[model samples]
Target: MICVGKLLGVKRRLQDMTDALSDMEAGNGNRRILAVGNEPTADLSYKMNEIVTRYEEQLSGLRAADETNRRLMTSLSHDVRTPLTTLIGYLDAAHRGVVTGKEREEYLEIARHKAHDLKDYIDVLFDWFKLNSSEFALSIERAELAELTRNNLKDWIPIFEENHLDYEIEIPERPLFAKADPDGYARILNNLVQNVIAHSRATRIKIKMKQKEKEIEICVEDNGIGIEKADLPHIFERLYKCDKGRSDQGSGLGLSIVRQMVEKMDGRITVRSEPNRVTSFTICFPVKN
Candidate 1:
């Protein structure tokens, strides 16, 4: 009688497990096998359920990635073609002497700017691909954070003056050391500044760095048209663009790349904004002992 009871109990639990699996197979990822306590098959049931749950999560992620790729390709096609078309028109007019003298010079100048725009777009795309690839490498090194940041921002001074932008840069005199990839750090700073210049119609910009506790912090602030509250959450998302009435001059990969680079270097970034008041991006990295 004891042996018969044990066999019946096992049979009932096996049936329950089978039904749970069937529900999962039918697209109910929430279904889980009811693990029998102290039964011979309990371990197997638990492991199998864990495997099914992981599979469901991975499948969902893959579907989301696919959707993102589809949108990326769509945006890429439109962006590349629009600039290329204008560039070709300019070049063709210049070549055929459609206009001469000042008109020709103007056409060539416009063509040059368009060419540069196309190149910038292509560069961003390449960076995105390399960043997402498995074999990408970083040359990490120990460096003074303040010095590196100063070197990076020095080049932007002339640019700011040319754009009639009032800028203030404050870096602590004391050296804050960090182990990071110099190129990656430069890219992060450049992308953030470029985003502000391209999107924000701010008259003044400020970049300041400070060391606190065991970490170093950098802030890039602009007093331009700030981002909308609804768009803040998705700003770091890949291919996400805010509906802030700015022209689509960017490939929408800048902030995404910045976040990825920061993560790769064991850092974090955050942002806060008040519409038409201020927008600031803050990045923090652990200081090397």
Candidate 2:
């Protein structure tokens, strides 16, 4: 019942409505008009404000999480370092003859051993921070595997003897060359052997290496109280402890560091266990022929 002129006006209004919606969708809102030259808009402004509010909230949450991590790292650094400094100082004093006799010798031995354990723990903590903060780079090169293993074994022989651990190091007569970082490979072996000595509580532990055409598999096996299935998956996680109460003799960082070091070498580490029967950590790394 509208006149032709009124119909044309209604059509124009429909066009304006379509244009406004299109402009909003395309984020070209300078063209949208709520009130012409004297423009004053409420609805559109409210929508934009709401979007900004949500974005700000999300950013705030991220910042808060970052701050919490910083605080945790700072506190951990302070707490762990203090006791370590004191332990090292006392051990040095005892070794330097500030104390003497069998009693002093025993105290010094305990101090030295515990200081080494504390050092291992701090190294793990710093490595954890690095692992989380940086991306891993595989800097591989050709190196003799047997020589590397021999040197590491020699370095740890004293510790093994001191702890009364019977270590059986099995290596091939001829050296096998592998592509990997010498330091990284050494750390992998050290962590595994250290775990065997510290947590395995086994009188005898073995390091067995298998060299194949494409990869090398090494395992540190022990006769010890094995890990539960539930604890296996979590053991590799950062700062996770499996023994409901931490093992009295260990820093709890050994296995975690082992996992990280294996991955850094482009290797895989897996554990197999039977409670009080045997526990073995197997690692495989690509070998350079």
Candidate 3:
């Protein structure tokens, strides 16, 4: 009689466990093994519960990732299409002779600017794609950090002047050598500077660099409409946009690309901002021995 009773208890526990597992496999992630106290199969129940918990966590993460990708596609459509449509409108007006004389010249210039804007947006999209892909390659080498930065910023001087932006640059006389990809570094600088130009309504900008212990520090500062506190934390996140009143000009990929390039070169980027006062982005790289 005791032997029969023991077998019946064992059978009941097995049946319960089998039903729980079936429920879990049928997409009921909330289903859990209910281990009967002191039962022979309690240990198996605990192990099964652990496995199900992990499975649920993985499924949740995958769902979140899929949602993010869906949002990105929506943003891509709006960002790429808006400027493209405007560019087409301007070109059509120009080609159809909708204006003449100096008016025509102004229309042509506006069309040209819009065309450049479209190209820049497309370039940012391509850069984002490349950075996220496995095949993206970097050519890292030891280079004179100060010299490379100076060469890159020189081109921006005229642009700053054209925009009537006051600027100051400070670089140490001593050679600052760092291991980095020159092209990537240049892109980083360009994106930061362009951010100030295109978004920050600032009259003065500063670029400063120096050696800090074993690291080389480069700072890009602007006395512009700085980022709000809420947006600062997310500026580097892919596709994140500030809610502040600054113009939403780019494809929202510039800062994201900047961060990826910095990390690929074994460096990091940080930003600090005081609204309408000062906004600074600092890049730190390990100095090459």
Badly placed stretches (over 4 Å) of model 2 are 1-101, 135-138, 244-252
Model 3, 1-289: lDDT tens digits are 5598888988998999999888888989999988777888889999989999998999998998788678778888987788778878877887899977788788888878888777777778888889878999999999799989988999999999989999999998889999899998998999999999989999999999999888999999999989999898899987777889356666677999999999999999999999989999999999997
Q: Which digits, one per residue and each the tens of the lDDT, describe model 2 over residues 1-289?
A: 7688767855665566567667656754344434333223345445654664565577678887687577657656765777677777777778788778887787777777767667777776666566557575546788788878888889888988988988788888788877778887887788788777767678878888779878887888888776777787777754455773225444455677778777767778898887678888888888877
Q: Highest lDDT: which candidate?
A: 1
Per-model CA lDDT versus the true structure: 0.90, 0.71, 0.89
lDDT of 3: 0.89
Q: Estimate each model's TM-score.
A: 0.91, 0.67, 0.87
lDDT of 1 by residue, 211-279 (tens): 989889999999988888998998899998887833456888889999999989999999999988999
Please give the distance, in angstroms, between residue 44's alpha carbon in candidate 3 and its true position after superposition: 5.1
**Model 1 weakest 10-residue run by lDDT:** 240-249
The count of backbone overlaps in candidate 2 is: 0
Q: For model 1, state the Cα shift of residue 92 in Å.
A: 1.1
> At residue 77, what lDDT does model 2 achieve?
74
Query: Whole-model lDDT, candidate 1?
Result: 0.90
